[model samples]
Target: MLELDLTARLGNFALEAKFSCETTGIVALFGRSGAGKTSVVNMLAGLTRPHRGRIAVNGTVLFDSARGIDLPPERRRLGYVFQEGRLFPHMSVRRNLSYGYTRIPAAERSIGFEHVTDLLGLADLLGRRPGDLSGGEKQRVALGRALLANPRLLLMDEPLAALDQPRKEEVLPFIERLRDTLALPIVYVSHSMAEIVRLADTLVLLSEGRVEAVGTIEDLTSRLDLRPLTGRYEAGAVIRAEVVGQDEAFGLTELRFAGGGLWVPRVEAPIGTELRIRVRARDVALARERPRGVSILNMVPCRVEDIGAEAGPQVDLRLNAGGAALWARITRRSLAKLQIVPGARVYALIKAVAIDRTSLGRGAGRFLAGPAEGNLEE
Candidate 1:
């Protein structure tokens, strides 16, 4: 487990972040700029000291003002991947990775050079210098170097921020592989909702210099109270789905969840691959009855769980589809006309195209085929 209840002062800004989460997968520190995302990670890294409170990971106390225990950065044995790849200019890719691996004693080393290079897909780039590598390649090398250190925790400070869209995509799959293959805990820092949705298992929302909420990405993203920070335009529900089958004829892949099956654009993964997807609230519309003879592919029955406070022209909605939560953003006029309220049963109309490929993500681990459900529309 990772825990922190620290207070620090930096000039005019005062931060009092207090939250604890599991170390199973990626725990993202998410917020806008100047929201202390970096500050919280810095303190955990021992680069910045907290004035009061304690910090611990997996029961090991990293810092404690009361006990006067503050471990140095190196002594903490944590791996950190910075925003920019800080590779040695003169060193080749092989040596750059070895620089950290060689420092750790053979007995303490949990990961080997060969394992890291292969896992990161850096075997072919071993002879290239830092200057010759692309943005994604450089970052992959950085990840390898850090892993060789055998860190108890991995801290990534927007590792993909410097790369463009294509470059980011190039490196995202490798990171997913790393998370699934390794057992190490990670604290990822980023302001991008897309990145967070694609990776994080738990989320720590920071606002200004404080933590607004801490929970699973699925729970927090569906919350109406956190819409202002989650971005009204991007606000929606996240669902865990399994690839049931592919319709090569229509260039679509069907995914089955607890609620029902949703057909999305063709996904290359084979049957049974579990993927997480976001359905934007704006893309969802409410209907009194299931409409037919229409182009919309998904029309699932749902019960209204809650409604949000009116905001000018639009208001957010919380829906329960089977056991899963689905959110929708509808205009106030529609709410008045439709008479949608808590416990009201309605149909949630979702367009197949609204769930884009960019938001699709594979859950960490081996992809297993799920039990065959009867109908694709069910």
Candidate 2:
């Protein structure tokens, strides 16, 4: 368990946060730029001292102002990956990785050098220096170095912010593997909705040095209050599904969710893969019935769970598809015309182009096979 109740004053700005969680998985501290995310992380890392409150990780007291039990960053056994790769430019990748291992006594080293290298796909670039690597490669090396230290907790502050779209894609899978395969707990800070949707198991939302909301992705997305902070276009629900099959002829892949099968653009994944799909509220349309002879390929029958009012002529609808949930944003006029209400059964009409490709991850096929079999049932 990780618990924190900290307060800090930086000139005119003040940061106060109090939150706790049970799992050791990735906990994303999410918010826009200058929202006190970095401030909180720095305090937890012992880089900055908080004026009051305590911080404990798995019963270990890292900071306690009242008790005066603050520990230095080095002794805290925490690994930090910054926005830019801070590797030694003069050293080779192998040398940089070895530097961490050399610090730990051989008997105390829990993670091996070769293991870190293989996990981050750094085996091929061991001879290369930081200067010779791309943005993604350098970040991978930095991650490898951090893991090799076998820290109790990891801190990532917008690790992908410095990279372009393609470069970000290159490093995401490795981070996923680390989260799923390794036992290390991660505190990842990011402002990108895509990163939070794809990577976070738990979310800690902050606004101007204060904790706004903290919970699972589903819980946070469903809250009407958090919607305004997420921005209009980025508001949506994340659904888990499996890949059942593919249609090579039409270049379409079949994904099975709780409510039914969703045929999106062709996915480059194997059969029986698990996937996390983000269906934006703006991209979903509510239909009164299962309309036929339409170009829209994805439609799922759902029950209206809740409705939320938005600024400037729109309302958001929360729909339950089988056991999973989806969000739909429609104009006030359209909602009134359709007479959509809570408990109303309707089909969510989704256009093919609305599905964003970059949000799809490596395990897109996993979700298609597991739940797809029963999702087609009426």
Candidate 3:
């Protein structure tokens, strides 16, 4: 487990962050600018000092003001990847990567240079200088250099913030690969919801230098009260589903969740492969009764759990589909016309095309061709 409770004063901004999460998968610090996301990571990296608090990772204490204990950045046993690569322009990629590896005593080294190079796809770029590498490639080299440090935890402060869309996509899979293949824990910092939804296993939501909430991505994103912070335009619900069947004729794949089933565009994964899907509220249409002969391919029975206060002409609804949480956004006119209220049964209509291919993520587990297992609510 990673635990942190810190309070700091940075110029005019005051930061009070406190949270803990398992040291498995990714824990994302998500918020807007000046939310203290970077400040929290800086404290974790020993780059900044907190007024009072303690920080411990997997039972190892990194800081304790009361105890008067603090470890320097080098002794913290943590790897940091900044937004920029910050590679040595004068040296070849191989030598740059070896810099950290060679600094560690052989007895303390747990990660090998060759393994990191291969894992990050840096083997081919070893001979090239940092000036000759693409943005994504340069970041990959930075990742390699960090891993070679054999740290217990990894801290990434918007590692993709400097990259373009294409470069971001290029590096994302490699990060996912790193998470799955290695036992290392990661603390990822980002403001991008797409990045948070795609990569985070646990989420820490910060607003104005404070932790607003801490939970899984689905729990935090589907919340009605958090709409203002989560962004109304990009707000949606996330659900975990498994491939149950395939429609060869229509080039579609069937996914089954605890709540219901959805037929989406063809998923390349084999049957029983678990998937994480994000259903945007704007893409969902609700009806008082199930519609027939509609162009919409996905419809699930849901009950209105709660209706958010009217925000101008639009209102958000929290729905319960089976045991899973779902969200919908509709105009007040539609809400009044349909008379949607808590406990009212409704059919949620979703267009297959509305599901973005990029939002589909591969879950860590694949089942044995039976009933869908795993908690969608989790």
Candidate 4:
């Protein structure tokens, strides 16, 4: 396990962060700018020291204030990939990657040159310099260099923050490959919910230099109290589903989820492929009955779990559908008119087009990672 209980003061900002996650897949440190995500990353990298607390990976102590155990950056055996690749501008990509490998002794090197290069798809770009590589390619090289070092834990502080959407897409699969195929643990830092949904197995939500909440994507996204912190514009529930069928004539695919099936803008993945879908609370319209002649193609039966305190014109309703949580936002007038109440069963009508391309992602396991409030992030 990767454990941390950190405290530090950088200038006027005070940071106190404490969280532990499995030493596998990706654990994302998520929040807005200046939330101390980078500071936490730096502490893990041994670039900065916390005034108090302890840090360990897989039971190996890297830092302990009480014990006076502090390791230097190099001895920490942690790889740091900054926003920029920070590659040696003068060297070729091959040499840049080799620089990292050269730092470790041969007896301790578990990863080799060919493996890192091939894993990142940098085989053909060996001769090119960082100046010639694209934004995404450079990030891959940074990752390759880190992997070649055979670090015990990898720290990425918004590596994709410097890339455009297309570039992010280019590097995402490679990161996924590392997370799924490799045994090493990764600590990914980002504010983007899209990246978190696609990459994180466990999410550590930070706000104002403190650990606000920590849990899986399914768990954190469902909390009504955390709506504002989760970002009002992009707040919603993330549902896990599997590809059950497709309709070639309409260019749509059927995803079998916990409650029912969803027909989305045809995903290219084959049948039996699991998917993670974002259902915006605003996009969902609750119906008293299974309304006929409606254009909405997706309707799942749900029970009202909680009604968030409505200080505004609209109220947010948390629903439980086939054990998965969902949210629906509607005005007070509609709520009373529909006579909706907690424990009342209702049909959640959703338009497929309402789910944007950015909202769709991949689902791991049986879609249940001990569901909580991150997307509740769900």
Best by lDDT: 1
Q: Summarize candidate 2's per-residue lDDT along 1-378 as a digit string, tens digits.
A: 899998989667788898998656789999889888988888988999999989998899999988889999888878889898799988999998887778888987988987787677788899998999999999999999988888889999999999999999788877877876788899999999888887877889998888898888777876767887775679888787788989999988898989899988877777777777788898999899999899999989999999986566988998999978888999999988999889999999888667766556435522322222223232
TM-score of 2: 0.89
Residue-by-residue lDDT tens digits, candidate 4, 47-136: 889999999999999999999999998999998888998999999999999987998899988888977776777888899999999999
**Over 4 Å off, model 2:** 266-273, 341-343, 361-378
- TM-scores for every candidate against the unseen true structure: 0.91, 0.89, 0.93, 0.90
List model 3 lDDT by residue over 107-146, tens digit each. Answer: 9887888778767778789999999999999999999888
Task: Please identify model 3 stretches exceeding 4 Å from their true place.
Answer: 362-378
Residue 218 accuracy (lDDT) in model 1: 88
Best by TM-score: 3
Instruction: Tell me the alpha-carbon RMSD of every candidate.
Output: 5.4, 5.7, 5.2, 5.8
lDDT of each: 0.87, 0.84, 0.85, 0.85
